[model samples]
Each structure stands twice: as structure tokens, then as C-alpha cells.
Target: MANEIFICHNCPMTRTMATIGTKWKPIIIYTIGLKQQRFGLIHAKMGLISKKILTEQLKELEEDGIVKREAFREMPPRVEYTLTDKGLELLPILNLLTEWNSRHHQADFK
Candidate 1:
């Protein structure tokens, strides 16, 4: 378990947490999750994210091996981002986190 961290519990949940536990990572992971989407698509979907921050965060996720990047060689070129198999595994966890946030926080996006 690389980067495994356990806190306040008996099991090692921190490694899982490390993947999507941060402020923007989980949001990004959850956004381009099911389908491979372009940077503009993700940016449009995530209203609050700025271009600079989005670029930085995407690079970080790419470095962490949780996200995959695909680029095309054509006029005007296109690049898309998608979750790796490891990143896909976090969907259910993100769903649970969203649920908990809804119940406890009351319209987190609002």
C-alpha cells in the first residue's frame, strides 16, 4: 500500500483518500469520470474552476497516475482526459461522499 495512511479508524482508508480526498482532485475525478472529455468540456462543467488552476490540477492528477491523457494529431488538435482504472474505482466512493455532503452540508454547490 503505497502512500497508505490510516487515521481515526482501524483500516487503511487514507490511500484511497489520497486519490480523491483533496478539494479539487475528487471534483475533477468525478467530472471527467464516466466518459473521456476535453479540457473545455470539463471546464464548462465545473463552473468555479479557473483555467490556470484547472491546468495545474489536471497535471497533478496525471502525475499521480490517477488520470489518463489522450491527444490527437489533427488540425486544431484535440485532447481528452479520462480516469484510469484506478481512478474509475473511486466513483462509488465519490458517490458516497456526495451523498454524505448532501445530507450533512445541504446544497454544497449552492
Candidate 2:
């Protein structure tokens, strides 16, 4: 155990961070958490995000078993993003953090 020196080959925290620590992932999670949304809706809420970042974040979340992506075969094709059971579980965590920030750092912010 002493020689382990905290190796991080596929560690859980590393994996969690890899999935949610990016600037876009939490925003994407929060956006989709409100309700299932199409690509445009998420993009509209986060106007500053580029298409490349949105695409990357969605793909990562889907691959990480957090977000679900669905596509419809309409005339122009339709797509939607939603949180999975795992993804939905993150909401309470985010909300708690929000409450904590409000209590502790409200003055630090406006």
C-alpha cells in the first residue's frame, strides 16, 4: 500500500472529473436537467458556447452514461437530449452546491 503513491489509472475521481469537470458538462447537465431539450434549445440557453464545444460535451456525456441522446426521422430530422437516471441524480448535488454558494459566497458575488 505504501508503494501505491496514489496511482490514478482509471480512478473514480479522475473518471468523474473527466466526465463532469469540463466547463461545458455542468452547464449541459443543468440545461438538460430542466427538461428534455433539442439541440437548439440548449444552444440558445448557452449562447456563448460554440457548436464544437456543445457537440463534444454531448458526446462525452452520452459516452459516460449520463445523458441520453435521441434522434427522430422527421423531414429535417429531429434530435433531443435528456438526462439519464445517472444524470438526473446529479441535480441534487448541483443544487446543494448552489445553496452552499449562496450561503457562503453570496457576498463574494453580487
| Candidate with best lDDT | 2
Candidate 2 lDDT, 6-67, residue by residue in tens: 65655787878877998788888988885989998899999999988898889989998999
What are the TM-scores, per candidate, against the unseen true structure?
0.77, 0.85
Candidates' C-alpha lDDT: 0.84, 0.88
Q: Worst ten-residue run, lDDT, model 1?
A: 1-10
- How far residue 11's Cα lies from its native spot in candidate 1, in Å, is 9.9
Question: What lDDT does model 1 reach?
Answer: 0.84
* Residue 43, model 2, lDDT: 95
Stretches of candidate 2 exceeding 4 Å from the true structure: 1-4, 7-11
Which residue pairs show collisions in model 2? Answer: none
Q: Which ten residues in a row have the lowest lDDT in candidate 2?
A: 1-10
